[model samples]
Target: MKNKYSTLCYQFKQLLNTTLCCTALGMSSASLASTHSLLIAVDGLRGDGIENANTPHLDTLINGTWAAGYKAAFAHYAQTMTDAAPNSGPNHVGIMTGVTAKKSGVTGNGNVAGGNYSTYPHYLTLLEQSNSSLNTAYLVTWGTDMQITNTADLKIDANDAVNTQNAVNIIKGTYSASNWPQGTDIDALFIFLDDVDGAGHACCFTASDDGYVNEINDVDSQIGQLLAAIKARPNFTHEDWQIVVTSDHGGRGSSHGIHAADNYTIPFLVTSKVAKQGYLSGIPRNYDAAPTVLAHHGLAVPANMDGTVQGQNIRQENDKGIDHGLTTYLPFNSNYEDASGNHTHAQVGGGSPELRANGKFGTYVKINGKKEHLTLGKPSELDFGTDTDFTLMTWYRVSGDQVGDPVIVGNKNWVSGANRGTLLLANEGNGDDFGINIASSRSDRKDIDPIDYTFNGWWLLVASFDRQGVATLYAGSPSGELNIIAGDISNVGDINSELDWNIGQDGTGRYHYNLKADLDDFAVWRRAITLSEVRAIYNNGHGSELLSLMNASH
Candidate 1:
């Protein structure tokens, strides 16, 4: 029942995935051998704790100094489940099953029994189901933390020392027959260290706590032993191994399960020859671990999983076209400076918007609905006259339903009949839609059909107008699926206006339609970007690093 276009798109997506997998593995699809993955979960490991601890082994993994010479780990200050308590049970379910507490039905440590693990089994179980010949092992310090399905070939619940030893034994193919079937290869292994969490509960959870830091240091030593064993494998050179290290949650004052940053902020790290170097371009979550492991093995991530592949946001050759005609770019990475190098810096107009550390791409500006706005002061670069092709794009996430139709970005008064220039508005006409309004005058306005939008999530919105008076609107989901709608707007005359360019509100003195949302990566192009360029900027939900794309040779 599918159309030709849809079928072709699906085939293209599959081809792209295969190409990317082959490139990452440095082998053809048919030549790829059994890949291996080691997932290490350090309970209550804060992002700052890693910085404070004396962990040389972890440092090498983070900095990509391993014997295999893999790329630097994609280390990120990721968050736990935002909607659920920052506790072990919920977070572990997320890490193992790639689902949030809402879907897993495990809201806290006390009610892990209520989880839907059968429906949403661990990634290892999924892998086994896909390929029964593959072997997997799970070793954890806490017996009660057995959230994963009993599908792994070997499951060991013991103290940190025992678990670490068993992990090393399995990696070296020296595990006893009584512990694990001899000669069985572990394609996927998960190790959980709980002593750090115990140390946090015993005293303080901050990095200043000597006991907590020491416990982390001890875990690092265990990790080193496991890494050495992996390197000692006879076929280690032929095997593609990916090591992922992350934490369920952080703690504060010997307790956690709160919404505070100290409780939710944790570390997500991945070290592999195929992994992209340096930090992830976007905010990562604990749930991303499962899909990341699955993707490393060239397995398809289930559509039901909420997590996405991590550390694979490498720039492709198609991304080089993203910088074409780009005139203004606002990364909002702790600043409002234009990354496009046009010097079209933003100036604070009303109350200052807060610069949030965890944005979709680096830092983002949080705008309160109450009078907070930013202005570009009518830069000539943003002035697109009629017949001049232009494109406006931004990534935005609204906190919730707004009290009024909010203007996300515009360069006009936006008054009907007096409207000039183009603007992107959210919840226009009190509807659950994003509207793109392009007008030359009040009577010569053209409004594209509203596109449905979601709240409390990142989305990319693009409005491109061609000299032929054709306007195209694209709404991109976090997963890189784009919904497009286009209309002919040749009826409109000049869209150039003298009004100052404004973000999160209309630029005029009338502070109507103020946006209550987080905004990042706002940009403007002098010409309408191609559809492929739009996809490149979206970057499969990782979003593009504008400067990197701009500097890349086409």
Candidate 2:
């Protein structure tokens, strides 16, 4: 019996060894790896051009969780000697090195006469320096991009077609296998498509011109081919790939270099499992790609880089509060609940408004179109004393298409009730001129330029009044960016602090017009918040989660 048991154990051990040997023979180096990345840069692509181009491959990325949608990035640069216009050389360098041309000293498209990559080490340099074994490659059409990085293992100045095939071959172990031991040896691969830029230069960027659109469509097809090749790799499933596609800068007509909005705005799309789906809030600059790529590989961003890893980093930074001068916060979700520590609870009066769940962040209150209103109970905290700085913030969506004045929030004099609060006056006098009016003080009133009325969409409204009686109104629609309106106050005197602080109704002593709007995240600050801070709130609901706590209170 002992001899029989020993023979069975030996047979089992031999079978296990054979299985292990077979597994080792079949598996590649990437099977045990964590992540890989592919960064593609398209030169001279416009923000509006993609809207006309049929890019189904890019559409998948934009509608998915990885990308933050259109107009997701900006090229922030002033005209300098090195880059007088929105040049690709400096912009691509910025994307690779994570710094602007001013800091990196690589100012123009022409290569530096006597310069080593000392000030601005390319992203590839950072990657290779961090991990010597990580394979990196850069395939570009322009020769100037060569000076940006010194650490890329393979640098090929080939056409987009050849580069695409080379990338596939590298992944398939056919091209330069001596350097890359396995088919999937490359860790990071960058491919530049210059056809679109060439097309733009050849023919003016007319939307009707097939030449320009055809180039974009052609590049999209090539990208599809590259994606197929990567997927077909033997060890594709084992490796995690973060695909990022973006443009260096946009162009106008035949030229691209200028400080205009059309030239600076470009499309940026990224795909990964952990990315959040939506328009990236705040503002994404061109240089953010380098840090983001570095972050994907679990590499630390060097302190020297100017750009930040934005999309994923926002969540982490959000955990730590960015409330610089947050005073009174009333997240209208659930109820007229104030999230700020200050007890500025809403006093429901005109009608019994109920909480609904279709709000931007959480739940919002439904103010009936009749005479419904909610007034802030404590007036001292909201009313900035005589000539004091103040700002009003809220997110609301109009339900009814009322042509009359829709008073969102009001603080009027108890005596005269002249228009001394914030009101969204739609179709007031004009058929479609929707404007905002704010009475800063008892007799002082400021009128903002009218915007075309929009309904059924969430709108962010911010009205701020400084001590000097200058008023600024910023409004952001659901899809559109923020719009600014500035004006001076007329009669800057004592504010009527004792009056009722109202929402969804014009409580200005005389008028009782109610607003049929879903209001949420209403906040009032003692001091006027900066424009950047206002933009932050509009881009990403920076502190809207406090509304959950407000909901819990109910």
Candidate 3:
């Protein structure tokens, strides 16, 4: 009798579990049907272009909430060489692999003739992971030739008008669009528009760049067509949906390549099945484009990916949205004229970075490779860990003239008689490793973990010091991931020394030096920036793009 009772109970529990799972599935289907996601990359869109053009379609996009903008920090980013060389291979690899060209071991578009060169460490698109369960497909134009075919189930050869119309038909409620792959799959579609970057290169970024503008308009019209198609499709309303659209890089000198502001800037946008969330700003790198689909389908982001969730901010969020209140009001660089009457940007911390040492305001030396002194700017002080929650942000273009990276130090009171003092952070040249100094003395050292920055051509660096003196440095995403690509995990901000604070100076007395690049948009906050805030930086609101179009030549 006892055995029978136990058996009965086990069977009952199993039956209950099955019923619950089925019920969950039903709910998911209802939401999933409405939750269709699309990721789009508009080749060569600039943050500054939005302000000067008639981008009504993008204008409708809100700069926060479902989508936010964030700036990216890359050393070298460009569009293409020529019509025959319409290759953004490294950038495309950055997208599908979520790893930068440097990190994924795929450095440039192609250094050879008629072949793909992205195979040192084979990259896995988020699609090949758990997202396999979902119907994932990549549709692209000429830009796809760079690398999309080598990544996943991406198509290159297709009739543009027909394929677009077919996609539109599927988007609308028109009998599920007979041409689409059949299944109850949670589909994530990614597409790219090559006309923007391609045309932008031929034409400069100005009112005269009508060809690029019209191309964007054409993209908008097709998007509208897709919207209409989805609305017409049967059972389409039952699936959940999200759409992400962005660009790879912009143009410079009426062309692209090399580490120029125009060539490195791009666009990222996302729209949920419901609600028009608006513009997302400040997207970090081209690689951040994929993790949305991967994370959505419950796949882990590859350890090597430099992408961030800020790419896909569209969610099924209802009721007033989460309170994403993170703001930092620090000006990057004010206007400055040189001795030759030529214009150039000043060191950002303060205006001119010129400080009076012996009671003279103009008395200052160049700490960061600048020939001029910087005043009216925030001086970088490394005495941290005092604030309960502090975050630092800066936009910098490192010139190749780098002695070494200056590190932020802690434990001020120990090193100096006053609060504390920081030693210069430098590569001991002992090897390709980095170690921290407690005192200005090399012998008085507490060896930190070895870091590799040989590949840091020029990227934005943001370091956050949490409460417990546990410091984490972020090269790409501020709140995205601690490691940019496949980098380091040293307790960077962890300082327990009684030292004084310093800026731009390293252990060897070298400065926080870098050559070949421009820097701007420096900020610091008292608290951690929420995910929503990260999205805002990607849009046109706060830090949508790093450089200003007015200073395009700079």
- Top candidate by TM-score: 1
lDDT per residue for candidate 3 within 181-203, as digits (tens), equals 32223255666666666667777
Q: Sort all candidates by lDDT, best to worst.
A: 1, 2, 3
Candidate numbers sorted by TM-score from highest down:
1, 2, 3
Specify the poorest-scoring 10-residue window by lDDT in model 2. Answer: 72-81
lDDT of all predictions = 0.76, 0.63, 0.40
Residue 467, model 2: Cα distance from true site in angstroms: 21
In model 1, the runs with Cα more than 4 Å from the true position are 1-33, 314-554
Instruction: Flag regions of model 3 displaced more than 4 Å.
Output: 1-35, 63-87, 111-133, 143-163, 170-186, 231-237, 273-283, 311-554
Q: Using Cα atoms with residue i matched to residue i, what is each candidate's TM-score against the true structure? A: 0.55, 0.52, 0.47
Candidate 1 residue lDDT tens string, 280-389: 53457789999999999888998888888887763222244677678888999889998776899898877778998988778899998878989888878887776777
Count of backbone clashes, every candidate in sequence? 1, 1, 110
Instruction: Select the stronger candidate by lDDT from 2 and 3.
Output: 2
Give the least accurate 10-residue stretch of model 1, judged by summed lDDT: 1-10
Per lDDT, the best of the predicted structures is 1
Distance from true location, Cα of 244 in model 1, Å: 0.6
